[model samples]
Target: MRRTTNRSAHRAGRAGRVRRTATASGAALALALTAAACGDGDTTGPASEGEFSGQTVTVAGVWTGTEQENFQKVLDAFSEKTGAKTDFLSTGDNVSTVIGSKIQGGDAPEVVMVPQVGVLNQFADNGWLTPLSSDVEQDASQNFANVWKDYGTVDGEYYGLYFKAAHKSLVWYSPDAFAQAGVEAPDSYAAMMETAGTISDSGLPAFSVAGQDGWTLTDWFENVYLSQAGPEKYDELAEHNLPWTDRSVVDALTTLGELFAEDDLLADGAAGALRTDFPTSVQKVFGPEPQAGMVYEGDFVGALVTNDFGRTLGEDADFFPFPAVDGGEAPVVSGGDAAVVLKDGKNQEAAMALMKFLASPEAAAVWAEAGGYLSPNKELDLSSYGDDLTRQTAESLVEAGDTVRFDMSDQAPAAFGGTAGKGEWKILQDFLRDPSDPEATAAELEKAAAAAFKG
Candidate 1:
């Protein structure tokens, strides 16, 4: 819930990330058909020893613990099949800083899992990354969505391949609470407002909005703006190409006020939301005598519910698409970690081999089974997932197609997007505390964006 807590809960999600392109003359698209002709699927079973034999490549990433253990299975398979050794280094929270320091120290790992598209682009621009090899480019293009492909590409060269993604436009609700309140989930923004009204009238709070976590509030702003203002406008705003005070933004914020404006609709009202963490936000909704009817956040919310809170998905807690505003379709705000190869790595072939391995369905399946992982690979076998609902969640993302957009805040500058207790985070918190004045809030947003973007 970065949007969530610091442990397993906080490793919430990522968007498009990728690697260098195969050719300055070729598009990532041109190789897709060729990759399909070669029958692209999870083929990482084993490999014969050759030029890369006995080579040891290192990978640095933010995941650890069971997540690390699960990923080790993939690494071990790579080692077994290719006769190449690979070691993983956890990059901690400051991956950009750590990678930058390593680059300066001339000791960069062969490959690094970059979490933010914005930061990845920064690396590519700085010429700190090696462009993708032809084989890696074709594999990514064939398997990943064009949006993801684009995220990895800069100046016509691919550098990051998006391996995983998280869908943020979801509202998790308690079926029991909805039944008790006698209100079904809403299919449209208007309907959701009405549903909340119904729940409030039935003597229950409607939403456990996590105002304590500014990222959650930012996601709240992102989804509403994306659906209401449309992707083009959303993109313009995300890149600071448009001002926050624009009518589309004002309209989205005004629309958000419909729910936030009502004190009774939120769990313990604005005061409670300000005090509630992400885990507690969900806990309050599904716990004994849930004070609220629902919670809105990324897919990790479901993971926490099933893993941490010990709740069943379909029976206890289920989510619906964050309904659209103004007759638009729901927007898919994708998130995840992206892996890239370093330009100065010692074992180039082994590093490329690891990226190629990760792009496969077999690699994705390994993490899927280990739980708390979701992939955007169309070739992945849904049956390999542990549960039906988890599979369904993955399927829902794949089905989103062109409607998918990376998390807007994630794509913005860190000061504007990533920093907590600053920029959009603080402004949005101010918003939940006072939705009646979106005009004032939008002005504050514009001021922050100008300073952050200009700085």
Candidate 2:
């Protein structure tokens, strides 16, 4: 349970939002919350006494498989506390398109788990999201950092409450590979490249490139750009206030080229990489045969390596921070799914209740105890996390405070940041294939960004 005192005024404002009224039931809920705090048997608080007994709250999101199952547990906890039936609708990859169609067809879900900040902004701007009530805001303020609030806010009203978070600046590698190569986890960009070269020189490909997934390329560019140009410049580029052709962009690309330019450093060369999707890329490094020595991605890769490949984190597989660049500190780039209420939903009251519950440490603990999940809730006990690596990762993000940033691509419009074979994604993949001309790549990026940001 890390804490920060920098946002005192913001926290004060949040504290002023709403105060709990004392009723017999409210007092009982408070007692239950206190007992839950003491690590008692009932961790999720007491079941509601027929509050919203017949209501069904539908939640739309992109989660499926294990992720869907884990999130359902959180919803179940909410249901138990509020006495409402909860239904989850998986919208697959095209969340915005599916949700938009549903809204237009008068069939919007009561809540939506939005994955991108840009998409959340679009929804909020279009008046499709309901403004969260004061009680919900106060709960969010108490349990989450101000940055989470900032992400969910639109024109001074909070809407989205982030439930699941991803720390995206990790580089996973095998300790055995590093030992065989006679190298160590790096502290700087140059050292990481040297490590890659050493690992490759030892008869294994040093890195696995997920070139087919254009979003991964965007992430590569973001980590470099953030470390090189710093936060203000990062914000400028993400918002398109600064052109992509700016020298900062070119510099970042050039720094990234230190790795991308070396064909020997990447597994199966650029052609093979271009055909590889994200899961295959991970498999190349941690799979049964182990084609490569390392892979870079978010903490989610831990789950894949542990579950699919039968590797143990901190043993067979582990991660290091994305190394520092140009004498600057490494930046923490993060992504998350925000929970927002639908403006036209019939279960507004129950939806708001769920939102409040989603903001609590108790709800966060549910997912944290389940593997492969991270929470932005500041008050969540680190012990709630199932393992040390997971707990440390969550602690790092929560303690990063003002220094932490959302994924740069996720902050941009989907056309530029998310779509495959288009905009930043395509431009970066092109850059990945041909690192000889970063200037031209920057120009292409500027062109795509200019067009996308105009919308």
Best candidate according to TM-score: 2
TM-scores, each model vs. reference:
0.88, 0.90
Off by over 4 Å in 1: 1-51
Clash number for every model? Answer: 18, 0
Q: Which run of 10 residues does model 2 get worst, by summed lDDT?
A: 32-41
- C-alpha positional error of residue 3 in candidate 1 after TM-score superposition, expressed in Å: 24
**Candidate 2, residue 19: CA error in Å?**
23
Per-residue lDDT for 1-455 in model 2, tens only? 01111334332322221112212235223311101111111133335564666777778888777787777777766666666766677788888899899888998888898998888888887889898888778777777777778777777778888888999999999888998999999989889988998999999999999999999988888898888898778766777879988999999999887788888999998878899999999999889898899999999999998888999889989899988898876878899999899998888888887777777777777778877899887777788889888977887777765566789889888889988889988887888888899999999988888888887
Model 2 quality (TM-score): 0.90
Ten-residue segment with the worst summed lDDT in candidate 1?
A: 32-41
Each prediction's Cα lDDT score? 0.75, 0.79
Model 1, 1-455: lDDT tens per residue?
01111222112233333322212222221211100001111122223563456666677778766666666666666666566656677778888888889888988888887888777877886788898888887777677666677667777777887777888888998888789878898899899889888888888888998898888998998889888988778767877889998989999999998788899999988977999888889888877667888899988888788767788988888989889989876877888778888988888767777777777766677678788778888667777678877777887787665457788777777888888789889888888988998988999999988997787
